[model samples]
Target: MSNASRFKFFKSHHVPTLTVLKAAIGDFSYAPHAHEEYAFGVTLAGRQDFFSGGQFHRSPPGNVILFNPEEVHDGHSGGERALDYLMVYAHPEQVKPLFADVLGHERGADFRSRQTLIQDAPLRQAILELTRLVTSQAGSCIDQENALYRVVERTAQLGGHVQPSQVTHRPEALLDLAREYIHAHLEADMSLDDISQAAHLSKYHFLRLFRQHFGMTPHQYVMNGRVNAARAALDQGTPLTEVALRFGFADLSHFNRRFKRIYGMTPHQYQRDIAR
Candidate 1:
């Protein structure tokens, strides 16, 4: 389907609860589009120029940008310099609890609405680490989940919210429910089309926005998650073949191939190495 035609919002399990993308470009431009849920990110290198809320914004590294759901916006690389940035896409439900927990308020109350720019060095570094962990396939599941947790918790803290957002509060309020679905079923056979449909987007548009916002495509996110899960299982001496099937891989060979590709060693070797 056409990109525009896929603009409708949806709720499904294939979408990411959180995804991060890191991009370096001489020039990049995103045409007008609106998400059914909230979008937020930080520029990490050079500058980003975008039109949001009827004004042109030039965001430099260390600046955060938060856009309300369904806000029309466009973006491009600024000036003659290249740019790099990290972005996160979340459901209102995911974010709402953070605000409620932090602010102790009823749902729908704005938590410093519009966009926010974070210039603190320590905060910037922490955000970058979350993005890195989400995109990288190297970390253990415990490490990766902790990293993701940090991202959410820190964002809540920085945004000054009182409560941790629950996955169920706004089941129909935003696209985050779809993300929760992905998190719960990460080990199963999942597809981009499946995720796109969950978000009420076509595969192409979903891929585009998913990459733009999260920094990693849905496939990469799933692979990274699987790698993390496998690491924990392997470290505990789960049988290689069983690990493969338990994580929904087709067989031991497929699992071994993927495990080696991400971890730089066979499953048995990985277990042995980790045991040392």
Candidate 2:
């Protein structure tokens, strides 16, 4: 919310698979966080600094930054000047279909980007054009999809992936039950004990294991589920007030703030955009 930072997010009905972020930051700093999607960033002006893959990086103009899914990192401006950049986020569920032709599903899903920082003219161009298409919202569906694929392919070419090794983690049934409980009781005032009890685990154990497995807390998961359900209802022309109440938001203002945080727009703004 600082004056030194700004973020504009754009997602199109034509290309729902990718979300574009246009950002300019000077004094603000990002807390360490990771995304569930692949993110590619291009620096347009000034300098940007971030840490990822256990390395510190400074990206100047014309540089591209790549972050794989669940890659923990933080970012901010590198100097006195603001950092102008564009980032494209591609979800795995959407991107997996695109990789079938280029790298096959098995290899592509396993693929990880190794270059956290680099200067690649082709990749940078694709990303810039992608930001243009998504933000402008003035291109054909085919055009947008083509641009997305071009970026994905160029990114895949910068590969640092091998056959992913086997891994073991928590049992899915407990988490599945927990998620079911959250969705089933969206309108209820659920607490940590409520959810963890539904999962049949101790509160602290469930909290730790859930975050480790899902990258988000139990409350965050519930909020996300509620927002997503609200989105669906809005698409059905449900009244804003009804949608908020149905989703268990504290009030219209609370709904507005939380929805904006999740979808990058208030409910009213989102409705208007979808209408357009």
Candidate 3:
């Protein structure tokens, strides 16, 4: 396939469920086109006029834009300032499962079609942070993915203000509590049953709900939590065995396997890498 076809294919599928690209370039105009994925992003620093749906909109710095998949749109600079922005391409299929499960909705209507322009300082800062994480090569992909969700959450919150009925269930409170519990109990032997009880949900229900809320199963979340803790402990020169026991792993071998699975390196190697 040609480059254009390849781009289209990736946009449709094969790319990660949600991914981002940060652009820095001179003024350029993109002819009208559409993709079968959500095109949502922030106009970081520059001026651009985008024509979408039935009208033309000029987007400047701090403008948040969201366009539905396969929507016809074109972009051209408004003036001399070069455009630099962060763009996240998300598959509706990926978003659909989470929203459906979390908000107890069958389908998500386009409450903010095309895009909701967010200009709040805190919201903008959060978006920038996500953009940085997404575009940075050295940062962890898991961390970047989580940051991307924050951008989405903030966008939804701000947009909901303009359209009062758009806000979905704000379950961050519950998720935060569960996270704190996991951190406090990392050194103790805990199972999915234990965490489910802490989250105040039945085992199967909690597994699905936690994934919907935090974008990962409780097991994956705790594994990641422990891995992060182990990394810090190792950095502080904690012994490998202690780190394993502190994180509730069965043994050093088990912890090492999981650490390698996530970080692609053994615990000792990770330590050496950090030292280097």
Best by lDDT: 2
lDDT of each: 0.58, 0.77, 0.60
lDDT of each residue in 1-276, candidate 2, tens digit only = 234766666676686647777878867676555665789899988888987766789999999998887676778888767888988988877766666556766656667777899788999999888888888887899998999899888877876674343433344568767877987998788998999999888988889888766656787777777886787677667999999998888799999987766444578876665554
TM-score of each: 0.46, 0.71, 0.47
State candidate 3's TM-score. Answer: 0.47
TM-score between candidate 2 and the true structure = 0.71
Quote model 1's TM-score: 0.46
* Per-structure clash totals for the candidates: 17, 0, 2
Q: What value of lDDT does candidate 2 attain over all alpha carbons? A: 0.77
The lDDT of model 1 is 0.58
* Stretches of model 3 off by over 4 angstroms after superposition: 1-15, 25-27, 109-116, 138-142, 159-276
A best-first ranking of the candidates according to their lDDT comes to 2, 3, 1
| Residues 160-252, model 3: lDDT tens digits | 312243334445555555767887887777787777777676778777777766545677666777786686688677889989988888898
